[model samples]
Target: MGELFNRFHATRRNRRRFWLSILIFSSTVLFLFLVFFVKRHEQKSLSYSQVEPDSCVRLHEVSGVYRIRSERNRGRIWFATAQGLYELDTLRNQWQRFGPDQGLGSDKVYDVAFIDEIPWAVTRRGCNRYNAKRGRFEMVAPGSKLDRAPLILIEEMEPEGVFFGVDGGELYRLASLQAKPERIPIPDGNDDARITCLKKIGEMLYIGIENGWLYAYDPRNGSFHRYVFGRPLSPHAYLWDVVLFKGNLWVATSENGLYRQEQTGEDTLKPVKGFPAKGAFAFALEEDGFWCGTPFGLWRYHARQDAWIQFVHPREKQPTDFQVLTLFNEKDRLWFGSLENGCGYLNKRNLEWVTAFPSLSRPNAAALAADDSLVWVGFGYQGGFTNAYSSDALQKIKAYEASDDILEQSIQCFTLSNHRLFYGGYEGFGYLNMATGEYDHYSARRFPEIADITDIAVSPSQGLYYLAGAFGVVAYYADKDSLASFSETRRYRTTALYAEGDTLWAGTLSHGVLVIDRKSGQLLARMDGVSSRVMGLFGRPDNPDLLLATKEKGCYRLQKSTLRMESVDIPDKVLPGGCQQYENNIMTAKGMGNLFWVGTRFRGAVVYDENIRQWKRVTSQQGLLGNQIRAFAQSDRYIWIGTYGGVTRFHKPYLSRLLDIVL
Candidate 1:
């Protein structure tokens, strides 16, 4: 009996060891899975890069209005925009913004409708309804069927619900905010199923789909009738907008222009004659007339004379209010939203003055320069305009006169040193006396070789200004007021410039950096092995390695001691579905403290901390107007980023928490 007891104890001990081995194996597998998930999900290498809202302000107001509606008794005006929904208190004149933070399904809200004074929005994320008391949006849909919802229309008749259209030709109705979405069958006609606009005419519902097709549905009969615009539509043709005016139908096509149907007409839509633009974007109905928003501007149709009156933003031209996208009118106040300039309404008789002003908008911020007291934004392309604003309030300081000759050209690059703002662009290079607020511009006539300047650098060591562009590298001595051209780099296409000691680094299109002596204006040696297409360069007196930014290629650490360039490894991603097109590009880079901030053409920013040798990436998801970054300007407390869409300012103190993720 003793022997048997001992044997049983031994067996039990063995069994315990087996179970422990199994547990250890399972834990190992689980740990591996978690590691893979975190690396894949968050795109984490060293740390993460999502920042809180307080850290950044996307000042560009990415507000492209798609639809505008007024809440009559509520004294509220609702606008569906590209970024989010905006609610304006017409009485109190206050604006309340509703975005993803406010529980919105998505930021891309295309249409918003109010039923029973409650706002219902259709966004790329799906259907959402506002809970006013809670001040947030709640999702109201079955699963994710309403995902990619773009157009919404209210139903006043029986069923008393809202009809929303999804991108995949699927339409759903919500009988009540709390109820599930019911799918409504839609007739197929166009190849593209994405719905663009929706309008309700009596019991018949008009649905405009992409691909230039319109469908009219009668709820009573459960039937759909398809109508088409004249054939041979452009390859990019699509129905942008539709409206009912004077018992007739009017529709706008993306590329084929505007179309209209007579009160008693055929299934085919005829092109609107005398319409200036080939593409009309939006329409708003008035008492007897209708307003058409087009690429040319806003046109108001007069019933009496059957003519159209044009109204555009006075100070801007083609790139300004010329491309009117959305319009809405309330009595004498005509609200209009352009492609860039947020949204504003025009009073009666405001149309005439628009003719005089011609509505050319402020030039887009191509290059940015800032100091303690002021920030100067320079525009290029359609003639340059230097706008100076107070750093405290960001209010424009009308310091330059309209007739200034410098304002007539585009400013491609700017170099601010010693209160002298040196600008270079299509005309050549010029200097604006920031202290005196005086404009002293130089045209191509001043120096023919400096024309079409791409980049300019000021040599603090030698106090000489160097130019690199289409005409190649040139030297200008401010003290002597002399210009010298380097014949060796004369035909070479230079892109960027950096001054180090007495040597000037000029990045070329394909030849690499042209290291030249600032005093003699002579080319030293071409630094090869780096990118043939270098963009921007950042260096410091203490740092041994110079950070070289290149187009499409990641940055490199060029050792000034050895004159060798080495590539740095950039992770494939930092977030899920993020930076798919990231080529590890560092289009422009600037260094401050231990951090180097670089902007990409696609991604908003990528920050590197030298202390930890780690990096973080940020994009539009982190509050950027647009991802195509062009320029950057930094102050003590704020860092400004200029993109094709607009400028973004980062509050440095608050931003540190998000960017300081490495160590």
Candidate 2:
């Protein structure tokens, strides 16, 4: 009886053990399957920021307008309208604008002129004189309350001084309209006529009046020469503007194009075939010719052929599109200020249309890095995507499958370990495979939940991945099948994370920085008492410290849990995105280098020089299809820049430099 009872007990024990084993195996399989399924799903549904237009140019006011007075060029047209002032570069297909925002003044610019080497701008407040050599503008008006019109025609006149034709066909002068312009009236025969335009030649000031009458006032004698055209032309027609070119007086009328008379004695006014009938209003002097502004467009008077060459508004021939409001010549190009479309540029040689400036859809990106054949980009609030760039012969590949994950993923930092690429985003920690475009499961649903992963670091010694999120830091060991968690005294938002040697560094928005010992998983040091919240962190080259770029505090270096402030200053510079450490060098992958590069959200890439401590900016000036930098990677010697526009390469210097360091 005892032997039979013992046998039954042993049999029950064996059955229990077998059932337990089956349960354990099934649970393991289910966990692995869930992780795989989540990762696979994430790789398929990726999306990016929606592209849209933000603002428009305000009409009725000019933004930028001025005369470029340089050594080779004199009195080139420069103008500022509400849209912005632009310099017409005829050869190139663009316009250049300058101001206080671009560096100018607070008053609205109305007119610009040059006298000898001095330049002056007329504003509603007063006349501003400029010393171009010193790049300074100051109000030089002798008084206050100046007129709204440009009346001076001298080669070297004060900003506040102006000359004009009187109503009586005589010449009058006003000194410093800003201070209350008082007219120095010159007596004339026709006292009821209105003044039109004025010009100064040699020692005489020529004035055009409303009755088609012309008068030349000698500054020496204060006398006038009443020159009137014969009855063949309408005597009541008002004259527009006048100029002296090649020792001849060129008269512009309201309806008639231009009439020329020689400077020699007994010269007669004759109609020139070169001038167009009607439309021509303002006159701007150029290097080789004089530019005329009309309602249709700008016209250049070629002296050799004695003909007017019109450069109409640049467009696709939609007659009702944009209307030419004003025109100026800057450098060598003709700037046509428009009513609807901001502005237009005309090429000098071919007189063809170039392009227009458009608003940016997405905020620019910062630093971009690639490792293990995958690219990582750091952005804000909600982070972005990843892409792949192969250097050899420009192998273009998307870093993360766009259709794999949710469209809007907040990724701040990313790193690579062995064959896995990890990302620290807003929601959770995630990884991707190097060989196949596959992702590992990401979750914040586990116990001690971790949401908003700020930075990521990998332990080369333990082959473990460290993720820093809003709550604290978590370490995941794939090989050992172990996971450890570390919590701070209080919940804090992590900003940047990195690992150097055996120490791990995590930066936070409000708490400054946290340094941890890898083996013990213990907090070693806390870098607090900083001016602003930390935005990025990077490991210095060949140094044990990390670099932190703050929200408003420029940049600082942290070594051995010690803080070292940096002296670098960015001028009119705003740093975007976050930072990353790779191969002993620190980098900012967001839109901060050179000028910040734009790319795909998943894998925005940035190229920079450690020695120079400068970032690469992808700009239209550099021939990049677009500025959004998504992913970046280095293969052998080549560096690839993956962007929403497409993948670009910087091979020669970049590839050659890496070869030296690697081999």
Candidate 3:
């Protein structure tokens, strides 16, 4: 009985141990299965979150004026700036801007015309009509005949008709934008000639061609006749403007000053006396006198006195030498639009000139970088630098000429890492420690071959820094304070560099991309599937693959594991489904979460949605400063765009999602 009881107890203990082992094994297996399932689902259904256009897109611009127009009463002024179209509230002294979201056809507005008190504009793309009731510029349909050509000039004709001229010197009359335009014949019959200006008086229409040709048309007779200036004007002279003032016809030329003739008597235009010899580019008619906008200054002519008075403010440090491009007159107020400085307003009663929308002399922004606290923009060549704490206000950062450590004044590229701001230029590379306000510089003397530092990349984990320029690629050891050659291919010019973990990718001007081992500076591989001129490279935040930007070839994705490259087809309304022809010259690229942003040479920036597998392009049509993008940088809430015109900060909530993963 004792042996049997002991055997029963041993059997029960063995059974319990077996069940315990089975439970442990099953639990482990279930946990592993759940992990695998979740990861797989996450990868397959990766969310490239999107923000609403209203809440996501914001533009920060340093107001650089392009043109200006005023109302008949001069109570309100509209400024066409490098940034966008702005309406100045004279009473409040503030500006209200209109952009793509507000219905602008394009943010880069070249000229504006008022038809029936409604503002219509000519942009880089075509013509747009402002619909005040809808609060947006209604874009003309792409199928319209006008869309086939670029419209450069727009003017309102008599009896509720609009007249517009295309770059090909084709003039069309539209009774209403909804209706098809009626083609008007030119005297020269040269469809390739560029139309520069147009004016109307009584039953006659005056047309100015860029090739120093002037024509007069009679709407009643439907006849075109060329106007002779009687003087030998250069064949290549540009006819800037034409105006009908006080029973006289006035014409402005780019090379040969100004000319005037009687409205219906003179067969030839006579040179206007007391005019600037260099030429007048713009003209405005006044009740008592006429205003002429010249390259050097503004000239006011009194018809009664037959005398000229010039307005200049060079001694007062004002924009006296501003190349006036256009002028508007309202009662006692004279508004002058400049090619460089912003618009100038003169109150004839007080003889006071107030320049509105003051801007940078040269705002050719080339490099951009931003953090949550500040945004930095570097200009091209000798353009200098500027920064802004708030995107709404950009202020110039003074040059550190007082410090001998500061070598290059013009910045070409910028990178911000670990509170250190790194800048590269034609001369060398330098860094500014943000926390300590300490600055240091390095010159080509230390790295003789690197005469110009085109790009800089940092690998914090390895404490390594890489520089790419005319000399190819070079690596620097922070601990040893020494530099070594990463690539000896000096013949191939390097344009950009990106560092990821133990790998460094260099984009060459004509040799595609080079992959190097950061640890040993070994050439691991070469990617040449795309065009030879690789403009930029960006690493995937979640994967080892890279997104490559190329010139004229669009973008491509390089798979790290397979070493296979495939072109990314960007679809557009004008392109075929598989075509990559819409703005293929990509300049820069950045990745945020599963979304990729590509900056192009002419088409602005494109945003790719990985989840939807679609792309949306943002340009001047979409409120960007300009289409020519130079560089891009991102912060927690904004994507900073460096453009040829200026820097634009795009507010993106998706960046916060990326920060959540990183932090």
Candidate 4:
């Protein structure tokens, strides 16, 4: 009987082991199938994220290089752009930019030159000298005679002399930094002509003027001679560029070919034979001969071949020949700048191209964000570039150019969450993952649908991105990868939004602000007396308990917890359009002070200082890039102003301290 019981127990144990092994094997097979399926799906969208950036969005390397000045003695190279000034750091091989924030007279810089190792910038507003010790610019403060006259040109000659041309038909010499400017009279028949080019060779100052006139003047002996070009050009063709190369005088003309000095007795210039005209504009010298930049392409005077060689042709490599504005010989590289977007250098040793300076790929810098080592910018709105640039030593990381890809949209704001860049634009709202670049924007193609986001904001503490406009307020939770939108009221025409700890401030089209609770989706408060079409709403770093709201007509300060509202202190001299004008739904500046900047259309920017309780207006009258403000980008230490003219960077000296207050 005991032997029968043991045999039955052993048989039962064997059956249990058989069933357990079968179940384990089936589970393993199922796990492998699911893993394979998920990975295959991820590969299609995420393959390029680890190795490269998107092919649709790329680093735009051009920002209109208008002038170049190399202060070799100080190992400093200065580049003038349509926006502002850039100083090349040879040690790091990077360009350090300076604009209106650095007290520059204007960002539309006409020329940049270093006299006596001190950098001087000339702009449409006037001339300014860099005070290295102060780390800013001081306007060559208008003297009594100038009377805020617009500056047309500046000329610097050897033996410690700098000359400036004013619009009142007067030439003044600034003897020294301290001495007052003294008027230097020119010869007869020159008052009405616009000076185009100024070249000083030995003691003779060669002056080229528009309306076909050239004058050679001697400042020491008061001797001068004037000549006019009657051939190869119209009577009004401006003498563009005059340079002394290979011990001979060469001049460039916009109408036809280059003019070379033919005889010692002839003050007249004759067009060089067998030279390609191509609308010569600027000159850069090489060891053998020289290079002339033109509207058509880049032409080099091959001294060995004695023929003009077309080095870079337009349409050969994506519209390179769109008017080469300036060229320079820096070390072993030949640097050339274009009228709009072609600014780069050609390596003489390897014959490769390198574009420097991290400016806008297009005209308007719509939005800006920083991710680790890369700074990303999105271009859109009026200028119609519909492009963006991510810069790391000016590499072409990605490009977004096709009609289907661009869709002519403009990015209004950007916020990063979970390694993804969430952007809102006039077109729509989308997120760009480092692992997944957006494509076919509206259709999306395997990606999630982009929200209808005309404007948006973010809350770092809550890990939430707030989406407004048409759909009301939508909160995207980054951690859960989910979206929670409060679409109860579609009537909320939210023009601006600001998210604090537990509250979200939404400024609407009317002169009212709606305060909402983040957790409950409850309407907390409502305030009135704000300007219509509320444009700006944000919490200040200095006072997190208060909110600042801006509108087309004026501004108001609101209490966060109590929902109290008050009118901002307006300075009498803030130029009629600022706190009192309608403009800017943007961020402000920190670091230097509790500073808030309001961008205007005609007035550059109106700034309010919380600490000092004061206001000041900045414009081209001060040192801005342009008077027409289009867009704005704010980083940790800089506020970027994008205008119809160009872009400018303003520094915030005390940004670090502001964080301490908020924390």
Candidate 5:
């Protein structure tokens, strides 16, 4: 009986083993099938993202302009815009922009001048001379005496010389292109005084000072004379412009209106009648009379009637609100640069207004975000509206202006979470519910500490959002509808934030980067030595490593395992014509599959392909709207670039294919 029992137990054990083997085989097959299905689905989706070659890159819209420079002899007009320098092609009716990528010293051109038929531009950093043969702006006196100084104005002197004014009220004269700039001593120079404008009439050079004084320098005799309006020592006055109109010296001032003085007489300065009492910024000489630009509008001084007539916009019905900053007169038109309204031209014969180049309305593109269906772009200060574009139809764009509900007009950064769009701007943080089409805003009025929102990061697993700005870092609990700050984030000037698994990275203005343990709210690591001001941190879409972008240190990659930072090598060809230092001027960096994209404040955008180890650049020459890239976003099919000029879309697959063919 014992033997029979053992036989029955063995048979039952064998049957149990067979059933376990069958179960294991079925589970393995199911897992394999799921993996295959997912891979195939990804391939199908990628194929759908491919676009045609003709639609590889397209410009959607243009931003408003700030200043205008005309070269009537060449039949070209140069626009000194926030984007860069744009030359209007009258024959084609198109605008061509030049930036660092196009070989300019910098993209932020404050003033432009043509001396000896050569175009020269003065940037906040230094001065650049345009090379017509090479079609690029070459830096003048780089790392020399003229370097590392903020140039405010540039004007041609008598005979064949140019004068440049530094922000510190020092004046330098360039006798020729090959000659070194010689310092021209100011009589009783005040270090606090700044040179605003310079004009030359006959043998005299008229220099306008922000201290409300106009200096008349006789270049031939080396004599200096100062002219003052109001009190001789009035500190409230500011001289904006100096010009010669109808053999009379005309001066525009910030405190007083317009002043006119005869060339030969008692030289008594008299204020022009029927002009704005304040904020007279610029002037232009006309045949019949003179043109004055003020805060109110453009005014024409009729010589025959001695009466003033204000030119109003046909559409607005009110006087043109363009705060004209500079003026240029052509044979038949008057060009005026505005403080916010881009630039305008008036027909001299009919006294009609012409909207030459409409302002981008929003000058600085601050933040960019995109999903599968739409792209959202935010602007910086004075940027009147936020722009949106449909991913499927990029030509269709919409603008969101500030209203009673939307208090913030300047957006600094944006993020997407829970099917909603969240933005941080001049005032505070806000969110738009995509499903409900509802808008909700929060500002310093509610949370006084949260002002000047610069960057944002969302934690999906923890159901929280992180905001970084002037006040450091703050946490928003979506469930609790509350904002709080952690001890680790205090006392740090954080400008940007990024979230990863179990860790949050905070980019500071001067302290480098701070890595914190999200769960414990404790600082884990402080990554220094990358840059003084870290602009952004991004993770590679295909890899676990991280990239850090900075203001002057270029870009660096942080290894996930070792956390060691390594500098990424940028191709020299990406920025030709002595613009190699511009690699460190990176503002934003993003990664996709095997390509890394970088955006700069001046040098447009660059894409590095990891597969073939190549770099490709896009600027105005390559059909981009502008070269000053403020923000960048990538969808599955397209890469969106937010520039000072407008929003540009690039088809990823087509670009990749084109690069392959070129390489």
Candidate 6:
């Protein structure tokens, strides 16, 4: 009986073991499936997060490169990336960036061009023209009409009109100041063909289509002719750029080396010898030689010898090489813009080689400003110092000699007018003479203790200059503008000051917007709808509405006398338009011609077209530093930017879609 019981127990035990094994196997399978699902979700989330940076964007320090450019003045370079449009600055081998929060038309600038001496920036939609007169942007047209979406390629027709190239290969021109744009026919044979390049040489309009076919149009006779390259190199001949140099037309292609056709010959193009290895992506004509910035590096064409000399910057180890896409000659030095890398600089006299600030990555600076007299760079900052560069040439001028305890050596804003140098910075206010280098401080006990002075504006109507700071708004008499601080009777942390006739508009950090009577230090009208942290203030010279950049609520268009406020919608993708910085929105405003450049803290910068009511953002893809902009200033030649990374400067319109696809 005992043996029979033992056998039954063993059988039961074996069954139990079999069931346990099955359970374990099922559990392990489930666990593996769960892990795989979680990983897939994480990857999707990471990609989505990259699509839009968090409100509090943190910039990581990468690397640095020494950039030396002989050119002193190019316009402030504007860049567009997957993130936004940015004003980059490069100084002391550092990089920085400025975007929407600071002040720009939009956060996505695809291309930029200069028309009527004004900058016209392209976006996904239409185009915007900078109105330097009113200090704002005026959209040339609404972009909604093009069924093609905003992938626009814009170029200037020299003195006046502008040319727009759509993705479908249709060309349109904003020839007149009419409300709507005019569409120009590209001749019947081209079909709805895509235009690869458009250039105006002397009196002829040159258009390049897919494959190696070139066409020339005589606007006077309405005659069109196609120039064919004898051999077929590119499946679709794509012309990238065309320029008139050395009595000949230099044509750059996507597959073939540089092609040249005599100005008199309408149908002949021969490849320039030395650049045989690669096709030209972008090129700039300097004195006698042509500087070719190909996908490889920088190449100089010696017209005398008819040869190409590739130039690369000197670095400690093997310097980072990139596809040079653009070139600018500042003060005789050469600056190259890379499509993937950043910018490159070569000092011909010193043979000093350098790249854009934060040179390790895509700090591509699209524009350049250069002059024999001065060099101004705009970029971001990496470690400590901001990326605003002032050439040793300008530093030698000794604008202000206030060698004595100059109110905070850190300069926030600087302006030179009528031979007088004005600086607004951490200290209070100061003035210096370019000739004498005599400097004086204006922050004394007489005025309420002011923290950092952010901005100083000289009234166009009145000679008086308005001082804005952390304290309150203060006005100093024009002629007696010495280092004497105003009496402490009035103190307000003012960030911006604008004047119209006798009325002065002030945007403060804590006190809302104040309209002060310039003559008397008394406040006239004050608006407190939003907070006192008014960042950007622009008084439309003709319109009664005042444009105010606020801290949280995007931008406000305040009615002149009524104080009625209207909120402007910032792009959903970009929030807190400026960098999500805890400090006061360190944005700036400058107007040249008809365009207004608004520098922001985080959103980088945007160009606003008051006429079209459009916005454009500049970003790193377009060759800006990063997106954290600190300040914006326009020198006689280039627009300057102060940022967290370093400094970057561009000489032309910058638009690169690759930045959006990449991080």
Off by over 4 Å in 3: 1-67, 71-74, 81-83, 262-264, 315-321, 358-637, 641-645, 651-663
Candidate 6 worst ten-residue window by lDDT: 654-663
Query: Model 3, range 1-663, lDDT digits (tens) per residue?
Result: 999999999999999999999999999999999999998667534431232334334444423354567666657777775545777667666566665556665556766777878787777667777887877777764567676356777777676477888876688888775687788777666566888877676667778897678887776667887878878787788888888777677889988888888555676987876675577788887777788888777888888998889877443355445677778777777877776556767888988887654333245667777887767666657434444343433333332331245435666787788787787777777777767887777777776756677788888667677888887887767668677776555656787787776777888887788887877777887776655567667776467677776766777788776778888777764223322455546666666556677777676777776656677666654345678877787777667777776666655644334322220
lDDT of 1 by residue, 52-80 (tens): 44356444344466677788678788877
Which residue ranges in model 5 land beyond 4 Å of their true spot? 1-67, 158-160, 230-234, 314-320, 348-352, 358-639, 643-663
Which segments of candidate 1 are over 4 A away from where they belong? Answer: 1-51, 61-63, 66-335, 338-365, 382-404, 460-463, 480-482, 573-586, 661-663
Candidate 4 ranges beyond 4 A from true positions: 1-65, 97-101, 144-147, 167-170, 225-233, 263-266, 313-321, 349-361, 368-377, 380-412, 416-446, 450-462, 466-476, 480-663
Best-fitting candidate, scored by lDDT = 5
C-alpha positional error of residue 180 in candidate 1 after TM-score superposition, expressed in Å: 25
Candidate 6 wrongly placed segments (more than 4 Å): 1-108, 143-152, 158-160, 188-191, 314-320, 354-663
> For all candidates, what are the clash counts?
11, 84, 1, 12, 7, 122
Each prediction's whole-model lDDT (CA): 0.69, 0.51, 0.69, 0.62, 0.70, 0.56
Off by over 4 Å in 2: 1-77, 80-108, 115-118, 131-136, 142-182, 186-196, 210-213, 231-238, 262-270, 273-275, 282-292, 298-313, 316-345, 354-663
Q: What is the TM-score (0 to 1) of candidate 6? A: 0.44
Tens-place lDDT per residue, model 2, 1-663, is 999999999999999999999999999999999999987665432211111101101111232322222222533335544432334443443334333322233324544555444555544334456656665565554443233333222223343346443323433345543344445454565554666656566666776766577777675555778665633356566666677776677777766656767454434677776466453455667656687755455677878776778665645366434445445455545555555554546667677764333111112223245643434443334235443433231122443322457322566555666676676655667667666856665667663445776666666566788777667787888777455777552366666666777777777777888777877777887878564656556664365545565554545655563465453433223225332212111223332222222232232333334445554433322323344444443434434443444334444353234223211
**Candidate 1 lDDT:** 0.69
Query: Which numbered prediction scores highest in TM-score against the true structure?
Result: 4
Q: Who is ahead in TM-score, 3 or 6? A: 3
Q: Report the Cα lDDT for candidate 2.
A: 0.51
TM-score of each: 0.56, 0.37, 0.51, 0.57, 0.50, 0.44
- Write model 6 residue lDDT over 1-663, tens digit each, in one string: 899999999999999999999999999999999999999788656643343221112122223111112212444444443333333343433233323322333344556555645666565545666666764556566553432246447766644466777767777766566645666777655647887776677877788877566888665665777775655657865787787886777788877777887455657777766675467766677778777766566677888887878676453233335566556566646766565454556888887876443321222221112233443222221111222224321221211112345323455665555555666656456665545756666654444444476667786344577677766766656676532233432566677777787787888776678887766666777787776467768766787787877664557788987888987665545434343354324355554333445666555766566666666656443334566665554434334444555344332221113122110
Candidate 1 residue 15 C-alpha distance from true site, Å: 48
